[model samples]
Target chain A: MNAALSWLESLLVLAGLLSPLMLPMLYFLLYRPKRRDGLASPIDSLDARAARPSFFQRWHCGLKVACLLATCFLFISPRGLAVCLADVAIALLATALSRPSWRRVLARLAAMSGFLTMLLLMLPFSGAVQAGEPTYSLAFLPDSLPLRLSGLGAATLIILKATAVALLMEPMLSTATLADTLHGFRQLGVPASLTQMLLLCHRYIFVFQHEAARMWRGMRLRGFVAGANAASLFAIGNFLGMLFVRSFERTQRVYEAMLCRGFTGEMPRAAAPPMTARDALKALFWLALAVSPLVTEMYFADFMRFLGE
Target chain B: MHISDGVLPISVSVAAYVAAGAGVAVSLRFLRPEDLPKIAVVTSAFFVASLISVPMGPTSVHLLLPGIVGILLGPAAFLSIAVGLILQCFLFQFGGITALGVNALMMGVPALVCAGLFRWLQNGDRRRAMCSGALVGGLGTALAACFLALFLATAGENFFAAAKLALVAHAPVVILEAVVTAAMTGFLFRVKPELLCLPPRSKWRGKGDCSL
Candidate 1:
């Protein structure tokens, strides 16, 4: 009776320890939110937000890309947890200022969760243990699978840094229309041809997506089901082949139409608004914000020495 | 597996950007004026096709199709892939902005090599062409997995296990891509032999049919 009670108590303790990790999975499986079709097109949301007179939206798109991207790169290799946390705080502030829908932010986080989960699962157990690093090995588990504290800290740092940058992407790119953003890239010395291709590709992505969806519906109506089998793969291949054939045909028609409209290999550039002093000041502000974490980590090293602790 | 930002060391990321820029410049050199819109439209199709998920035992994996893209686009494959990746980064955040260059090289370099391999190996015979497609398809994914592992391993010693796991995880995907690409190539060979004969530009003029 005593052994059984101890075993039950230990199981409960294990369950309590694991419950937090399982929360996300449980939320996804049980309380999955209804899909909002309105958020389906990222372009529509960008366009809607582009009309707003926000601080970021008012900034020159070219300068915005340059400054924000510089900041993001600065966030890449943070030396300490304090720096990582500071970057995350800055990112969250940027997200709040940008006013991107919470759903969109959450969606981006969800998209990266798989990779992050993999890192979290593997890193602690498999990371190399330095001579004096603390490690925990379960009684039943092999000694080879010791969980290192340093690995957990490394994983935490990576997750924080990555989340910061991911959150910052919205404020950087989505503040303006994608066209304006691509044009901004062009202004920053991106090849006109590449930008033009990106523009065209972006436009057609929605159309082709619709066509593919329609085709998928048709296939489903005919009792087609995807499975882990040779037949299913062949069906999918044929489906892809058909999509290619149709797109190829559509490409010819579209190009001919563009030729009729006198598209002489270049998209006509619209006159860009001149950069203002305000834009430069805003850029400087962002650059300073981007550099602060590094500044703190470097010059004030004693205060941020907790990483080693 | 697109590398998220902050995962790669900054130096590795910057170097990748430079190399990818060089690759895009070389690809652009081969591109003709009229081929621009055509490639753009085809890239959209490839982008959409990639969104389709195929079920594996307990999970599903989306098609990467770098080999198929290489087979279809030829010399222009790198540019097309970079464009698709940019859209993906902005729209879906499959990859982060800082890591875009590494991601491009990860997918695009394999595509260029596969294009070359497919061209060299394929003959007029449909069966031979299909087999070549299968070989290139598997090799494309295998090479991409290697690049991903290499990139991850560069981060630090701590990432080596994750890198190895990434390589192992792609094994199933490599097989799936091979079979799907082979089937697609066979279908294209039977239905539209011209597409397989030459790159997108020559096919526009309705020339270069393989006489199937």
Candidate 2:
């Protein structure tokens, strides 16, 4: 009964610390600005969303930043694997609830699985060989298991932590549009110029993607197929070089256009309203909640020790 | 080539950010105000470049093009790479938010190195420039693999095998990158040789024009 009570208490402490990190994400999901259809450009739609902000949308950026900060802190703390795993499970549940086009996450995971598999396979055999340590061998031959079971445990720990963070990123980022996130960064004092540069880069990526696709189709028309040979490589080289040349020319034209339009160095953004008292109070509450994990880790451990004594 | 988040300890992550920050600072110092748009455009190209894959067999592999960025952008390659990586993180979730600095370093440092090497060796010699391009591409991938291994090894003894595996898996990629970079360099040599030259740092501040 006592053990169950202690476990329940510890779980509660974790929940208290974790709730602040999670509530904002939930709030953003619930109160995210409704998208207005019939917008010609996605950028225009993003602007429309900003024009009619919800209560939670106003502070979503700060909330995400706070949650991520807390998550990072938790990751860094000397918590046990079980606790960390539990936190990761919570994050995974949140991500699933957010309902992103999850194929992206799956694809990324597919890419990462190779590395993770390598860790899983090799870590077991790489551990230091010690006398009287638990060892297993492949086949009947006496092959030394230099990999201690403890090493495998550590590898699992790192993998779980990494996977958890990666899974959590989708929901954390997906709920807010990229523009809003950048704006939030600006609110957090990231330079306006940098955000502007990022926005420009983001916009042009689609432009170049289309250009490259068109060029690729042109190549297909010319009967070019990728092959493992010098000639194919040369063809690819020409294609890339041509792409760069076109992109360079476009840059010059873009520069000229910007200058013609009175391209001052400043990036134009809609002014955000100043933070209110309620915003501060809510932020403080979340901030306190975020810190609770560290506090609990420090004090709860001692409390358990005291009880034992 | 992107290091996922939570793989790095906070201290290592912080250190990488510091190092990458220093690189960005140097890049910004050399960047011209007028060239900001060019940088943005090239940043987009770098981001999009990853999507263009070449079929090798049943599967396809994309170009990293750190060498190409280096050959083209010179000192500013780091900033371009940083922008590309940030976009990839936000849009594609290619790398994690916290690992941004480390991932940038893994790609950007190699780009800067290749840029310097290509400049030192190209010297208006077409044959030599192509060779240098191949060297830069191959060596850049190799070095990135090394960095990845070193970072993984920091986790402890258990990761040693994993590190080795990472490097080994990249061997074919290194050769393929060398071939592609060489091909691109050769094409540039015949077409637009001037693109091989680094842009003037800042028109008002730098000594010469952006030409070979």
Candidate 3:
């Protein structure tokens, strides 16, 4: 069962940790969300426009992506090397289709290679033991070392997997997941009020994050630091105080706004992304792919028994 | 405080899944159509009033504001906590899958109680209520620990030994958390009393009009 999970979980953790990097990559590669979406979007809809890269853009994107994939493969060590190869194929296809300048491609490729070499040399992920030995360690990191190649490999893989999960799965899952959760509550006969409360709370979270950021920044400019004692302490107290007052006032405004718009008990809806056969098939395919590693481990790979414990 | 997937027993996990549903059911009845705006407002209040974390040994634990939620929103706090927990889990993995329900209950039920306490303390110096909140917060943590201990105990675990180890180890951590919670709540009272509820119709008005 861990076959898919091992990779997926690690990937998610990686994505969560390296969100800053993965977010930009995802933005470049995927469909850009826009102002029109805001009517339906619960979060703030700022101009999420990205300056489109030109012909060179595609190649550079592809090249950079391939390099990321290489690093990811070197780290996660997905049970079947096939997935890594598939990613490589995808990267190559993307690069080919993108058709960047050859000179730039060569340079980027060299840079990619150099990055991996430096990562490999500077970070340790290698060890004396053979693969599938049931090495019980955090990503099988050893007791003593500057940087274990195996550990580095595992760490990188974990992060890469997270990025992949975040990029590939997040958009599809978020709304559906929210809906599913709401659906589950409704089925249980949870009151609409409670359900609505849940939804509103979720909606307001973005507002909190946004406001908190702005408030914190304003506070900082006015001399608020989390660590400093006298100045920082007083500033934090004042900043927090102001944040409270502002938050209180903001909610009232937001509430009044919602009321004016006829926010009934039900959450506003647009057409949900339709569930399709492709989605079903893809889901099944992924399940099988993820499960395969566990099946393999059942027979030839007792390695995890030692490794997991 | 968020326990991970493999941390709890199968029974505990299963029971929690069921209980999480039950918690939702219990709170659902009081919600009204007009409540949406207030829900929005209170929720907005929750977002701010909730932050201002207190520093503990290595980590910082903030005010859960469970009591405030319980008082204002009532059982709706269950859903609020649920949504908040889900976001926190997805965004930061603060509390992993297995511990999600327990974590929710730990923070949720207390807020439910805090709502009641809010009424009790509204009149006399409201600042003291924050102190009560700070203290009761520890009770919530203790209850969570006990539930977790019971979970391990029923599974043939050395619950006492484990509790001793965990509680002893985490005592300073807990107090540090409590102190910070208290201090932050204190700040909330002085700063954003509106977050707890609406600002008095006028802040400058005398205390006679400030009655809860």
Candidate 4:
């Protein structure tokens, strides 16, 4: 039993860490594609007594930040990249080849390849990327901290690292989260007021983004050039002010509209289904996978030693 | 630049996470649903803003805007900064997953201080407000270095020595942070003058000053 458990542990580690690329690829294919409509999604179903998609049905939030957090949990896990990628490629290829028609295979290939390319671009720009630098090591420490204060400090350190990772993962996940807000959270049984708020926010986000971009272009055209070296940042700041003003005014009308429709802090209902057992399992599985690194390094001597802590 | 797993002592890293978490929780207390989008915009702005880098010395360091966030969001500044910091860690590997908290506080607290100080600045001279943002931006970077130093010191006894060495390592970086922050402040003044405004004085008269 012990030997079998050990093998299972090894497999879990590999699944969690070694194959980062594999999971993302699978997720992209399976995600039922986002919002086939725009932010004001033309009032869903348009039938009396049918559920409407609360104001911002067609918009995406910044939930990518949340997905990235889950991704980091994978990065921390110990696994074999080559094996994972090869396995995933095989899965994709199998799916493609098994298709009854040539057109479907080509479409699949194009989609997969396009996705792979975006990840390739996103990585360099991702804040999570670490540059090569010398790291502090803890090899020469005594087995136990010297006293209670040492233990206190030990507790402090763990909190610090967790905060760092949480902070880093939050924004990235927020984007994916933004994208998946209504569908994902609705499944989670989030409050309607909260959902309505997020939907509204998501809908208007592009307005801010557009304002920011326009201000940026305007500033550049005016020679307020902060600098690619940094002279350009002034424009970015000034743009923020403009973005805020427009967003603020737009928000007032939205609030009034909601109030008129009996939106007493509670959002109108959408026909989102409840969470299923499959989603529960999927959530737990991913949670485990995300925290697998700490688990692996904590429990497995071999992996811990391999990581050279 | 945020250190990750295996980069720092486990004890120091964990402590940072806890403290930063507490700080974030405090911020959440005053949070309103409406603040989410503003926070998101600020979060995206901070994340994208760093992509524009400035060359200093042999290497380059991007802007750290915890101060600016603090100036804009006050104590709630932590949420905006945390979101941006988390995204950076995951996607770009700007910092380590393990070191997220310490980084946040190092940056977050300073921004908070700057936000408060910006308010106290001569009752809303736009230039003073920008200066406050500038100071917060630079101060946050400097404080982060100190927090990092303190974090290293607790890594073990040898880290005390390492902290000394690390202080020297951060000196030039601090100067650069100040320069960029100051430059950013000056730029913000010319481009976005509204962020420096203290929410129409009526905001402070309210019970809680929280945003998402």
Off by over 4 Å in 3: A1-199, A221-242, A273-309, B40-75, B121-123, B141-170, B173-212
Q: Across residues A107-133, which tens digit of lDDT does each residue of candidate 3 receive?
A: 222212322332233233243444553
Q: State the DockQ, from 0 to 1, for candidate 3.
A: 0.18
Docking class of 1: medium
**Interface RMSD list for the candidates:** 2.7, 5.0, 10.9, 11.1
Candidates in order, TM-scores: namely 0.90, 0.81, 0.54, 0.51
Stretches of model 2 off by over 4 angstroms after superposition: A1-63, A93-99, A103-111, A130-133, A138-142, A145-147, A288-298, A301-309, B198-212
**Docking class of predicted structure 3:** incorrect
Better of 2 and 4 by TM-score: 2
TM-score of chain A of each: 0.84, 0.70, 0.39, 0.35
The 10 consecutive residues of candidate 2 chain A with the worst lDDT sum are A37-46
Pairs in clash, predicted candidate 1: none
Winning model by TM-score: 1
lDDT-better candidate, 2 vs 3: 2
Best by lDDT: 1
Tell me the tens digit of each residue's lDDT in model 2 across B1-212.
Answer: 67776666777887887888787767766776777788888788766666676656566677788888888887888988988888877665566677888888988888889988887775566687789989998988888888888888786676777788889987877887888888888887777666777334322224322421
The best-first sequence of candidates by TM-score reads: 1, 2, 3, 4
Better candidate number, 3 or 4, judged by TM-score: 3
Question: B161 in model 2: Cα distance from truth in Å?
Answer: 1.8
| RMSD, candidate 4, Å | 13.6
**Residue range B162-186, candidate 1, lDDT tens digits:** 9999999999999999999999999
